[model samples]
Target: MSAAVPPVRKERNNMRARAALMSPALLIIGGFLVAPLFVVLVYSFLTPGTYGGVIWEWTTDAYVQFLFEKDIFDETLIFSTAYLQIYSRSFVQAAASTAICFLIGFPTAYFIATRPAAQRNMWVLLVTVPYWINLLIRTIAMLFLVRDNGPLNHLLLSWGIIDEPIHIAYTNFGVGIGLVYSYLPFMVLPIYATIERFDFRLVEAAFDLYADRWTVLWKIILPLCAPGVIAGSLLVFIPSLGAFIAPDLLGGGKNLMIGNLIAMQFQASRNWPFGAAAAMILMTIVLVTLIFYARRQGRSTVRLH
Candidate 1:
């Protein structure tokens, strides 16, 4: 052996090794995620070309166009509420989906978490089975089920639950149902993971201290499991907000959500800049939601400590 390496030299060698280990991930993120985001950001501020792509000329008209429309005759900017309505509808649908997922998923997750360890894997496998199928196939199947003459309506008629077939397909209600079906597992999995590791002793202690079920749920269980609930909510809400398949197939093109709006811009409308702007706005909303969650999580962690 030669003379021993110096401590600083050894540390430098270790850092080089770590960098080599991380280089692949760094390149992948930079190439795939960051570069695309940069392109979108640049395109959002550019003027739309005559045909489809962007012009090098810079302008904020794409963003302004969301809230204001140029009059057909005068070309004067008039306040427009149509885009706002679409955004509102998207948010409402997303929020409804999140709430519905939580309502159904929490109980299901708790049930799964409470089961014996040997059985928990089976329950989880069942929960995830539907997801293994193609989403488009499942959505189309849902459309068939909710259609006027579909089996669901036929069954309802046979049971005398209704005199006529309920119109669910190609409606907002149908969209919501599709969203819930698509993302319910996202809500369940996180909550189940959290509750699996949760200390049930705390719940028992609360009961022993004369806390009622509701009180224990509100004060102890809910608070401790808040991370899972929040995580599940984010999981459900974000995807629902940007959903394309459910809204497209189930909503029947009658209603337009943000995702649909963006798709129309790029494809039907052929306005790249506007599509980029809409995408950027959607990304901003998601980022803000994530940042808010992070800060709230940090504060809660501090409180616990």
Candidate 2:
């Protein structure tokens, strides 16, 4: 009270207080996220132990093995496209799941968002009810429903839809269905949030200007909800790309994805370094894709503005 503090000193003290507040969060992120990522990077560059896990020696053999395999007799590396196919399959399945989620989710979200505010929570609860059940349990339930001689097939056969039961379980179709069912809630929630906050006045204005339903949807609704669509797509796509259980159970090991490949390295092949390298590759691919998408979205936003 005797001496007034300088403004700069006061600001510096405030900054220090803010930094102290943030320290816990920063420490948690560094310890959990950054530490694990750094460990993976280091392991990716290390040599694989004969039994399992990594050796201390640095080597690029893990990265090299991603696209090539050593011939047993000649001990020479030859280009192999098997891993490429697995990556491609993962991408296709992920894309298909995302597309299906979007198609089903958009209408569902729109319908929910249009509901009376008093009843909106109930609709959201219904959408999210599946989350209360474990994903593995849900997938197994799907297996029971789609398997040959299961209730669904038996019902269809009884209805005389076809002479024989269609093989839906343990196939790509089953995996796709499981993925869509698992991630549909993720796709719905974001889009619903966006739509619920949307200015219905603009829709009315479009209608006042004599815009048809299709035109308004294409020119206004879709554009306005684009952020939610992108968010939902990323939410659905990323997890679908790394999907393990659905593919493992539904694909029956015949249709292997990148997740399966990673599991095989760590579990079956006992090559931790290769597995880490594969994980790093998948992370890099996801990062690049996100960066490209972000840039494109930025440009689109600028154009709209």
Candidate 3:
């Protein structure tokens, strides 16, 4: 005879309780995030009905419009046949923001990570202080500080540099400044996490071997911290790609990043399918980049090992 089977009822009860507890959070995220994403995927492949409804028929019209009929679909692309300007500009802005964030953040992270343990927390807090301020509020504060009659112009006027105020606010330059400022903390935190966990004695050994500082930086420190560089770059670039208020208010309609285009469709044009298609396109681009980054990082790791 088979051994007596243990009761499974108790095990089932435990499983049910766990699922019940997790259900609420799962429901909320699925309802808000996953559901909307699936809807976008569906909208991209389906037709856009009149009065902002989706037709039940399968079609590629929205994606086609994104590629060919850009003017009719995208607001900033109107009155021009340069169909991909918005996509191109968005790429440029995101790339520039990532580069600048890295250049400015790496050293700061290094310093903070190497400081005395007692001082590290204070420096990290100082780096993060700007994040506590509201994004829109911080962006608007920049506008006032750089506006024609603001402190910058006031100072220039006082120093006898120019008789008239310079146009600093409401420009691409202003938008870039805001992007860098808003995203700086994201860049710093990841790199700090990286540099903090570094094996500093390796650099000291490189120094004992009579290696120059630049050589040690290039061959030892940088290669050792490749993960951090990738982490910080991803953190900075992805979010800046979809930054809304910063470019909208600072660029003053002159700059047309992809984020603004997506927002315009939902809010101004009220075309849900087209907006969903645009978003799917942005998602595809981001996915492609991440795949490439991961592949490269994997290859580097293999080489190092």
What ranking emerges by TM-score with the best candidate at the front?
2, 1, 3
> 1-305 in candidate 3: lDDT tens per residue?
22344558667778899999999999999999899899889977876666666778888867777766544445443334343788887778888998999899999998999999899999999999988889999999988888888999999999999999988788877888889988998888888888889899999999999999999989998888889889989988999988888888888877778888888877777676778898998998999999999999999999999
**Model 1 over residues 191-270: C-alpha lDDT tens digits?**
99999999999999999999999999999878888899999999999999999999999999879999999998888798
Q: Tell me the alpha-carbon RMSD of every candidate.
A: 1.7, 1.6, 4.3
RMSD to native, candidate 3: 4.3
Top candidate, metric TM-score? 2
- Model 1 whole-model lDDT (C-alpha atoms): 0.94
Candidates 1 and 3 compared by lDDT, better number: 1
Candidate 2 has its poorest 10 consecutive residues by lDDT at 1-10
- Which pairs of residues have clashing backbones in candidate 1? none
lDDT of 3: 0.85
Give the clashing pairs for model 2. none
**Candidate structures ordered by lDDT, highest first:** 1, 2, 3
- State candidate 1's TM-score: 0.95
Q: How would you encode candidate 2's per-residue C-alpha lDDT over 1-305 as one tens digit per residue?
A: 51598888889999999999999999999999899999999999999888998889999998998899888689799999888899998999999999999999999999999999999999999998989999999998898889998999999999999889999899999889989999999999999999999999999999999999999999999988998999999999999999999999888878988998999999889999898999999999999999998998898899889
TM-score of each: 0.95, 0.96, 0.85
lDDT of each: 0.94, 0.93, 0.85
